[model samples]
Target: MSSTRTTETNGAEPTYKRRRTQRSPSPQYKLDDDDTYEPYISVAQRKQAKLAKLTSWGAGSDKDKANKLKEEEEERQDEEREEERRKERARKERTLLMEAQEVHERKAVEDSKKTETEKAEEHDAEILAAIASRRKLASDLELAQGVQYTEPVKTSWRPPRFIRERTSEQHRRLREKYHIIVEGDDIPPPIENFTDMKVPEPLIKFLKSKRITKPTPIQLQGIPTAFAGRDMIGIAFTGSGKTLAFCLPLVMVALEEESKLPFVRGEGPVGVVLCPSRELATQTYENVLQWTASIAKEGKYPQLNTLLCIGGISMNDQSHVMNKGLHIVVATPGRLIDMLEKKRFTFDHCKYLCMDEADRMIDLGFEDDVRNIMSFFKHQRQTLLFSATMPRKIQDFAQLSLVKPILVNVGRAGAANLDVLQVVEYVKQEAKMVYLLECLQKTPPPVIIFSENKNEVDDIQEYLLLKGVEAVAIHGSKTQEERQYAIKSFKSGAKDVMVASSVASKGLDFNDIQHVIIFSMPKEIEDYVHQIGRTGRSGKTGIATTFVNMNTPEQTLLDLKYLLMEAGQKVPPFLTSIEDPRAAQGGSLTGCPVCGGLGHGISNCPKLEDTQRRQMASHRVSDDRGGY
Candidate 1:
């Protein structure tokens, strides 16, 4: 047969076949292969010719390149299929992860909805395990290994016979009656009568002479604590015999030392009393003298001499007294540190350290000075810190300075003295000065007027004097002599009223202060407490009338309101109407836990700020030393 089969097979368009339902038989596909007329030899020659043509094209034409491109296309298609499979697996994995996250979230919500008891039960085992791990960590850690500790001298004296006579139940009743809150180990029992305490007959006699047959709440507890030679922090309202509580013990300790071995010239000052102000220092010095001078005059003991060390006083005079081996030294921080730094005197034999108006001292930037003074102690001393307000700052300071001190709080420290009738009166901002005259008429002579500013104090004094009111003014700006004169005049009833700044409000116990008029409301509730505390002292009732205007800060008003409510006093409509959101969140009653400022809390406590600033400053010093 010829090589050609049909014209249609010669590359004419193949006609489409229809109407055949049966599949093409395998015999028909085999017949087409066998029908070729060309011999096997001819076919082999044709394949060889085609192979040669392809090789020549590879060298000369681009068809060979096209074949290579076709192979690359097939490879790319295979790779794309593999990539699609990978993407599918990844999507499935993501879906599983999302489902797992949803399950965790649902479990967390279920746990959160559980009651605390239920939750505790659920977590009890894990909690115990966590605690055990923490305990293990603590056991494994050795922190502050380089810190040194020098123990103070332990007290050898026991409570006097009177303190022991009362059963623990009777003592508890006495503490409750006096609202005496004590915190420490081994607290001695409080006494009712002066004779209950173990004192020289002279003190009992002095007490009798002064018509002070019984001790005040602070005196009831504080004297016994000091007598036991224990370090103590004494907190009581103003005029609660706090001075006597510390002063009497100081005298007794000095007397004991003076009798055992008489202090020669340049030898002694068995105790030191630190005060924040010159007035307080002088007052304390006089209080010490009150006991010592009486004892010496009665020929009951050796004479105990005390020196007053304050600024604006001649150092020569102080040195003269120091050279005589003083028995007690009452000093302000500046003068005391000055005397110590100058080596003018020493605390060598001093074992009793008393800080009077301690909160005021710490607040007045005297903390560093006080710390330096503590460093001057040669032995384990008995420290007594007395303050009207027992802020956390004072507590922390007492902790740092004293050893295992007893806390004798007559009442909650920041509380208003129930003895004082606190009256909050709303007045116009412009009419406060005029209303002051009416407030003064509420009580007779021996009145105290507290103003916020020094100039205002002077102005108020002048205004009162012009209105034919006998008024004396005192503040920090005044000369010490002037302040002393004003205090003396007020105490002696020579001045009907004393117009003073807050400087005179603390540690000044004037006789029969009938009323306290607050011409301007103080910003801090603690300050207000102290201002009113100057009156209502020594079992006598007095009234505190405060003039509040719209100019006062809302926080201050809120503090006044809470204070009034707490004291069972009447709250003015203005104060009652004022609302603060913080009151809803544990702010109305507790005030600032750190400093006792009712206007703010721990977040914005001024005392906290001061403490942090001081700490930061100290850390800066360490940072400079490259302690990191």
Candidate 2:
């Protein structure tokens, strides 16, 4: 055997000699005696040779490098496989999350649908109950017919004798306030300068189109005083053109200033009018546009960016408009205060201030906001205050807000329009429904019934509808859309009777209302006046019949007196006889010597009482004192 061997050479190849394996090993490194010669010796030598070969191969040929490269390639494949698994798991999680979200959204939509269905069911039940409640009455059937019931033709819109009462002081005040001493016997119209009336031609034309060419005494006199740059307080009964009287001059002033400025782009609104209620504010805005449409067309007025800032509307939408700047902003006190606090609008440039229904602002507890608004105006701006009645509170407000305002009394405060008849029906509170039905039978169609509470209005509306009457109810609780729909239906003759809360009684002109029935006596005499005023509008002859229960004797008496005064009639002596034991009375106290009630004297009875004063005062102390 040889370590190296050789083979025979061929024609094209060469052969090499090999070491002989049969040769014996050196004696220092001998194999076992029985062992033949071996190519590689001990394990140590094999390992050393292996390492050496590896080292040499690494240093020269790249075959060992190829093996390492192949190992790395296999490891990379394993890592790629792990990444694919991770990505699959992630995809599964994402799919699950999306499916879960979809399920949640579907559940939300189903819940909303269920809520709407439930609401519809409730509304349907209410309607059915209302219909069932009125089936017993024939009047209900008449109401269902939507037929107009015409009131008996009255020779005059006059009050019955019992309700026609007056005090000496009230008479004197009325005479002095309305019939002032004349310098001469001719008794010229109160207007000092008729020619000074500066109503714009456009306004005159507009009024004529509305068939209102002749100004009410208030309009004729108040317009000039206001136009003459005098702060004014115009006190008049409802239906006395109070809105137009204030609106004509204010719009003209805006137009006059607008003309002086170049027709080029400029800021809007030189005047800001405030009304206490949303409907009033909206009505005022409409009247303003109707009066100023000609000027608006002539480009003599700012585009009248009229903004209505009222509740029940999106504040965001309001903010968007306010940020754009308003030429005229008609708003309720609360919403206006809200926007003002947010710095959404400024009144720095407001030049003219007209508080239409100035008394309403006070009654509505908006005095603070009104004062707040006053602080924002320029010191020299003109101010005008208009009210259906001039109570002491309003007089005080005038003192605070107006600077030397010229007093224009169209009719005495608390004076009723002669066109409105005041009628009080004495009945028990529980019998109101029956009495109302009876009155509706005889009282002709198209009447308004007022209730103090929204629930009462709802009850009454339901009752009327059941009795076959086409009536609609409006109150604070009704959605804005519902209230508007009711109002429009009444206006369009789609509905005959409207059962409403206090909102309907204020600043709305419902001329077609032939009669108004107060289903119950109002809480305050002022409210009673406004309630009845709805019928006798625009100098149109209308009647108001109030239902008074025995429990409300004091209110009935006071309301009767107030109503008479508003109608431009004298209060009869009986209304003032509070000391008369036979006179109507209430509130478990000594009779009013003036009104025949223990709570107040007839002569001293304010149209509306102080809220706290009407409450039982220190009853415990009085009881301890053994006072009845």
Candidate 3:
């Protein structure tokens, strides 16, 4: 046979072939032959040979057995280690559980011994007792006389006829300038200046030093009324100089009384100023100190004494001050009540009682506490109530607390400041954050962002911080120190934005605030007015931007629209067209048809169940009679 084969190329068809085969070689009986035979071995036989090579009996007999035994020992050791590790883990878990149970049981036992109210009461008692212990009674001689020192009686004198005529002319000018309305017989005329108001020479000099030459409308009216020794309710816009309006009269009266019959130690303060918040009390106290210092110069009125009695400070320190002596006490209702109850001080000699931010005090449910404090005064002291707005509740309170008070409404009650350029933007609730960010970019620094609650305030503050905005927050939950620091930081230009709750709505005087942003509409219209009032103060123009959404209460929106219109600001069509969501959803005043109850519908009525049962019973009785 041919050894080569011919193949077709490309498209050619012819081909030739030759078979190629080789004969098997004969096996050789030699060691070299073993190597050759191994390549030809079957898979099963080859695997058998590999197993034999690896077995102890096949190679290095004793050494292989020793290696196998060593591996077995290692396996046993590893198993023991794993078992030990699992047991240790179980032991640790058990120990932790036991510790937790012990801690829980101890807490449970302690909790069972006393209720939360009892624990709080006990803590309060300890604090009060400590304060009482620190308090020292007045010297026998001082208490017996009931005055610091007796002064010769000076004959009371009235203003000269020319001064009275000038005062009348000034009053007319003030009424026209501030649009002030006064109602009551013998209404005192507003003063032309602090000098005409009969403010002490020292205070007038102090005011001049501070460059406060003119009197704000509230001061012009409120000061004269307060000086006349009549209960007065002064209503003015926030930052319209209400603090000085009431404080000037207070200091004047206290100084005059101090000259005649000074307060002795433990005789209690001659004047008590109640504020709604600790911050307000502190602010008022600082202002009072400034005024007192002006009058309390060396050898001037025997160094008039004042003290701040507020919470979050050591009561013992306050007690020590009270024991030393305090002519004036500025305090919150709760702390003042606590001091009065503990006898750290008395209201027996309290000749003047002023409720600053009286509307807020009443809103916080301090009406009863205020009433209790008033009971201590027995209505003999002059009560001066000052607020930014005059709600009906406030009017009711004034009726009960004041004796025919002269209602001094600076502008319309609960109306926002005319100076503020109010703008309303209709936005979705979810898009408020984005809108706020956009607003901040355009608005200048020294902005105040008012949130509806503390949590929102914190959230907005944190978001601003994340966006590299210099911001601080003030709310009721913050300590007094934190609140003070935040306000100071904002005032010093260290912070640009302040996120606050309604805690900052009353009596906080941020003079240079350029913008007020309402992150959420307040539940009350008065609060909205106050929030915006934070800006446009002290004769400076400001902008107030409010974000309104459908989720906002319909009544709040309506009230806001009315307020905006009253302020002569343009209202958006969306705000005008917004209907109450609840009403649109078929909510009605119809009563339950089954029971005529207002709360529920017929489907869920308890009476319906009984009625159905009775109807079924009647049907069964009718079927039985028909069968008979």
Candidate 4:
């Protein structure tokens, strides 16, 4: 045993068997295991033994045990809060050195990663430039091939000289074909004439400020019923003051309940307006603000707080605003849901809910969001569903939202404000731009050319400007500030022509829009109604033209026919001939014998391409594949 004194492995330190040079006198409770040979220990001795055991294990062992104990202590700090204050001095000292080292090491790693990221970006840029160069060469080669080899051109076709111009009688018949008629005599005037109706003065004032001297037939009927606290499903032609119908009631009801405050007014939104698109939401908000602001100016009205909660805005700002109350909020469904989840706003106190362009809201697949929002309201709120035309799907939403709503239609195929002169012209696809130029040269000022896509909108605007026409384009891709400037310029008579997409379709209040050119046929009949609606607004008469081709799909034509016919317009005999090429004009929905109700013949209907569509698709595909 004397020759076998214990030593540490590798480093030759004292081991378990080694004896201390000096040992304290054993306590009365000390055990053999507790010390070198004691078998029992006191509570104080045990605590000391634990501390010593931790220290003796390793340098890091003591630190880790201290950290774990500190974490446990922190967890119990609330119960031991007084004791935590007593131990604060030691607590700070224990973590101070480690925290500093960790911070320095973290910063060093971040700097290294940043340098690597910048280098990678530089490398990618060079590779992308090389790829672009190859794409450009390919496009050049294709253009050269097309120029070098050309097929014999087909003979240009011309229309019969007998159809040079349509007589007023022919125009009337065409309108009849589409069931477009001004049946003012048949449909009773909306009780707009009733002076004693309990309609709110604020709404009446709003209408006046907008320079609306009279309500459209739908508004006349719908407003009074809504004012009576009745739910309403209003079916009317587009541009017939439907917005005012629903908006007026919403504003009035909201203003009625809002708490008044001076200077630092709190937000207490009593009404909410939901729309499909941001453009529509913004337009509706502006309209509401214009009238509401005027009311505030009179010093009699509370500063009605109207907030906009649409997507594509700063979320942080939206969250902050939601914490504060709002008097009225105009929002698209998506952003409103996000805010609701984040507890930014509540619809609990919503006394009035308006779905402007209800058909569009449904068409855009917002029904589920709308339904979820409706559940948030406990009591049945005054609901209004406004649409240009009532499709089956929209009808379902209306029935669900409104509680026995009064159905109001101006007339059969509801007259789309007779002020709009709708005409259709046939043209070749390649010649569309030239035809547009011709129209500009011949048509009067303040014209709007509507395209379905932004690229086309930009192209048309640029082409028109190149031809020395003062035109500006507005689309979703443009910044809100840019859209506002363009709209202001157009309205101020500074710009003569505005090339636009569907962004200019709904609720945009632009006065003196004289003519609307369908640069491309709108996708839906309801959209078509709204597109032309822009022209003949606020009791102003306007002209609208749509270019149709023989290549226009029979289904599209039929849809157009049904849309017009539903509106009480008569279908053209030629359109009827589409279903029966050989049969005389008959009002029968015979299965198109061509493609067995597929709307095309086996050969022609299955894969038919109109001249313009084919050209546009080819050009678009080429541009995309050529990496333009």
Candidate 5:
């Protein structure tokens, strides 16, 4: 046979018969007619018709081949994805193993470097802090055992059902007019005038003689509550007659006791008043004296003895007064606690307890002492707590002490006086002294300059006196005599300016004070309010100028802005533009309600934090580690 097979030249072959490779796919059916000769048309019409019924021999075979190729491609793709997943898992496993080895090596090195004793010490330090914190917690729990609080409620307190001279609509209008917010149970409606206050005619004559015919917002609400035989808390701005509110009721109750019985020597005080500072105690004592003056030997009423038991004054004098069987005792917490502990006088006949500047008492670290004083009273006495600002720190004491107290909060609690013109100026710390000269010129004489501390008070007083400003300084360091002399001089026009610390800011009434200059702003905004309040007293308008610098705290600035805005004062651009997390609550609340701190919340209160840490530590140790 030739190399190329000879076949028919018509169509199936390329003119001559071509040999096919064995790898070529076999046809579905035999080409029966052409197998022996050459590749013919590949489909003889006769042969194709014979196998036509079998579609697999024709178009069906091509379709089957295409489906097989597609299946193979899909299988290959699945295998590739599976391989990628396996590789990723292997990579992760290797990384984990490498990390574990490194960690083990690091631990080995660390263990080698540290001695057993050193490690034990470190561990012990942490454990001790924990133990100390736990002790404080246990102590608080002990204090909390069966302890009661007035406790904040969402609803406002309703007035007690009593005989009222004024109509209910008139009472509603009066409360709304003065922005008085009342809370607690059995609250009595406020009075419209001083005539509505049912007291001895002698005290009424005294108020009339003093030209005080109308009752202030606090007096209207507070006096009635006290008269209703209920415990009460009075929160109002300074110079808003907070003193008269409690003082009037105090005098009335004392007179009532005096009317029923006569006092015997070495008997007891029927009423007791606690003040934070010696000056406040002295002033309150004077106010009580003025009210009692009508009921004393001078007036037609019976002689009612009121004693001022303050420090720097003779305890012998106080003892003598107590021995005479006083009607009322007004003394600072420190001296009062001492007097009570020494058995100088007993509250056996005491039916009234009035605490003025309650927040200051807590701040001065006299909360425990106040509690101790309360412990001396075996029977329930009518407790009255009055503060310009009611901080949350004092809330515990209020709750623990007062039983079902009526909270007569006038205006916004702890808000600065809107009537006082507040002026904020930027002055560097070093340049404050130089600028103070110009500030003194802003208002007339009878001005008060508040310093941050005693040392600063001395320095400012010296500078002002050297400049011939007729200034006098008062602070805790000064004896009661010196402080009284300074206050008298400032009030009598003997001294034009009174440079004092926060000790004088609480409840000292300076008549006709036109201006107050803050040499350096206090750390707290609440103090700032009280400092400025020194000038605006007894329903008169006043001015306050404060010096602030870049070094001043940002949170304080934020608080100051809100206070100024609340009082309708102009806020400086620098203060308004400032921002802080502490004021993220958008100034709805003036300062932190708990601690009166502008920089933090109740949860983050530094005072509470200390208590929290102490509660956690073993034996209540002093450390930063908080209780568990």
Candidate 6:
């Protein structure tokens, strides 16, 4: 049995061995079938086989795996670095673009400014050349005519012998005749009529043509002082012929100076008359044209030229007129300063500086501009300051600008005309319109209603129109055309009532205004006087009614009370008895001594407190540091 089992085992073993040989043949196998024999291979052979397989797959031995991992890491790092480089490149590109744009805008603005500066400089140069050529032509014309031109020598002024010889009785009579009060040395006596004022015959004929036989008080005294080349402050009411007073003397001196020296183009004006408003400037210019016409017609002052320099008009036209040469310039301060800045005109040759409504000009914030203009004039030039009221500050300005100025007060300073009957009606703010309507019904046409602001004026005007009352409104906000039309309509009796703001409070001449209704009184007493002065002008009696209310400031109420008492007007008991809240709080009624503003004392002044606190803190720090 063993022999037979052995024989069978040997036979099965041969078959099994043959099968195994057939399945796993040799170490070197086909590359395509290597994976088929991979499990049956030895551990070392399997590793070698794996290495060969990995080599084929681009990952062979451990060193090869490390090299592959290193290559992958290096590739990943390179890719990340490339992405960072791309981002950095994009950021640099954006930065460069932004910097380029900013540089471009700055360059554009710089170029524009440079161009404007160049154009202005070129225009100035052209003007200078034209002036030089005109001067050369004048010199040549004089040489051709065998005439020697010489600058007139300035002589010290002296009072006329006739004025010096006047007796005390004559002076007293002159003062009583015109209600004149003169202060300072060498005050000339007032004249009775235009004929006695020593006015030239031609000007007298011009005056007669206009049917102005009698001289107003301001003209009586102001004309003589101006003719004598003395600085004068003429205080008179509105519509008191103040324009003619300054105009006659200005024309006479301009003509006399022209006769001595030929009119030189671009030499600036010989006389400068500054008005506070464009309308006032226009009115003064019209008077100048009228006064200079007779002389111009007689060919005595053929080169006489009067120019009006005002805003809201063509600057080119004004410059053209100035280029032609101006003997007298009637201008507003703003336009005059603008022209002066452009070098279009100069004040070097200005012999007379006349400021009509001088106080109003200062109140309108032209004080600095006036000072700047005066700086351009020589000390010998005469200054004539005319206003209805002069405040303390305005007097100080006069002292600095004028040389021994003669203060001529025709009437009481800041006093309304006694001829105008003043009445005060105590009414609430809400009831103002109703009371106004009732007053208007009783009063006559040609009435002026003064409001505190533009909106109030507009509201009053609209209300009146709705009530079938023909009314117009004038204010600083109104256009020039609108203001002129409103004034014209009122003057022509087309509009029965004219509502206005403070713009019409000063220097406006309304001779036919029968009543001035103060719908709202102003804060300043001087303004109140001027508003009432508008009526009762030209020797005509008128009425003024004011509405008082709680909204009115305590200081304004007190001032109005004093003004009414001084003018002999009836003051209501409420106004006289109202206690000032500021005074009760132990505060000063006067303005701040440091900043000159109301409602606060110098101790509480913002400018003073801040400066004092900063100085105190600095001193404390210095003491703590042992005076370092």
The 0-to-1 C-alpha lDDT of every candidate, in the order given, reads 0.77, 0.64, 0.73, 0.63, 0.74, 0.73
Model 5 root mean square deviation, Cα atoms? 18.1
Per-candidate TM-scores read 0.73, 0.61, 0.65, 0.59, 0.70, 0.65
lDDT for residue 154 in candidate 4, whole number 0-100:
19
- Taking the tens digit of each residue's C-alpha lDDT, what string does model 1 give over 1-628? 2232334858887554435355676744565567666545685587578668867766645776678578669878999999999999988878777979999999999988986545534453353333223110000111123222234445455666656887988988989998998888777888777666767787788878887888888998888888887778898887788989999888888888888888878777788888888887888788787888888878868998798889977878656676777888888888888888888778777888888888766553775576668667665577788988877645765665466678998777788888899888889978888888988888788889999898989989888888999989999999978988998987887889999898887778888887999999887677789899988888889999998887887877877787788788988787888876564443334466556765455554545566668878988998999965
Question: Candidate 4: where are CA atoms >4 Å away?
Answer: 1-190, 193-195, 199-206, 259-267, 315-325, 413-415, 479-481, 559-628
lDDT tens readout by residue for model 5, 1-628? 2236566657666444456455667778556755576534643574465446544565567777687578668878999999999998988778767979999999899989986545544554454344233211012333556544344322222334453556767777878998888888756888777655656666777778877877888888898888776788889988988888887766776676766787878766877888888888888888887777775745556777888887788877656566676788888767776887888778777777888887766443565667667766654577788888887546545654466778888776668887799999999889999999998887778889888878989998888878888989998888768888998888889989898888888888988999999888876777898999987777889999999998777766777877888888998988988876533534333355555655454444445555555556734554434544
Worst 10 residues of 4 by lDDT: 149-158
User: RMSD (Cα, Å) of candidate 1?
Assistant: 17.5
| lDDT tens digits, residue span 1-628, model 4 | 1233566678866745433465589768645446556557796797677678877875665678789699668757765887777688667777767879999999888677765435444444454343223111012333345322122111122222332253556644543443433221112123433244444466467656666666666665666567666666777766677777787767666666653332133445677889887877888888888877776776776656678988877756555545555778898998888877775666666667888877656542565577667655544467777776555334544554345456666543323546677766667778899898877755678888898879999999989889999998899899877787788789889999999998788766677777889978763444577788888776677888776666566665654554454444455666555553312322233222211222222223321223236658878999999995
Query: Which consecutive 10 residues in model 1 have the weakest lDDT in total?
Result: 134-143
CA displacement after TM-score superposition, residue 463 of candidate 4 (Å): 0.8
lDDT of 3 by residue, 192-261 (tens): 6776666677878888887788888888777877777767888888778888888876676667767887
Displacement of the residue 98 alpha carbon in candidate 5, Å: 23
User: Which candidate wins on lDDT?
Assistant: 1
Instruction: Give the per-residue lDDT digits (tens) of candidate 2, residues 1-628.
Output: 2354455556555555555556587667555764767575896787577768877766655776788677669878999999999998988878777979999999888777765435444444464343223121112323355432222111111222332354545434543654432121111123322233544565556667778867676765566556666667777888888987777666666556555662222354467788877778877877776665755666544544566778877767645445543566677878877877776666666667788777766542565577666555543567777887666445544654455556777555656667876765567788889888877865667888898888899999999899899999998889977988998888888898999998888878875788888877765666777788898788787767776655676645665654454455655555654343223322223223211222333333443244325333545567779965
Q: Of models 1 and 2, which has the larger TM-score? A: 1
lDDT of 2 at 331: 75
lDDT by residue (tens digit), candidate 6, 1-628: 1122223544565322222223566677578756655435685786577668877787356887888688669978999999999998888778767979999999888777765435444444454343223111112333355543232223333445676788978987878876888876766667676666656677678878866788887877778777777778888876677888887888877777777777777875888999988877877887788778876776655657889888877877666566676789999988888888888878777888888988766542565577666556543477788887775445555654456678888776566788788888889999999889999875678899998789999999999999999999999889888988998888788889999998887777774788899999776666677788778877778889999888887756776766677777887898778664456645446543333334333334443454457668978998999955
**Model 5, position 187: C-alpha lDDT score:** 65
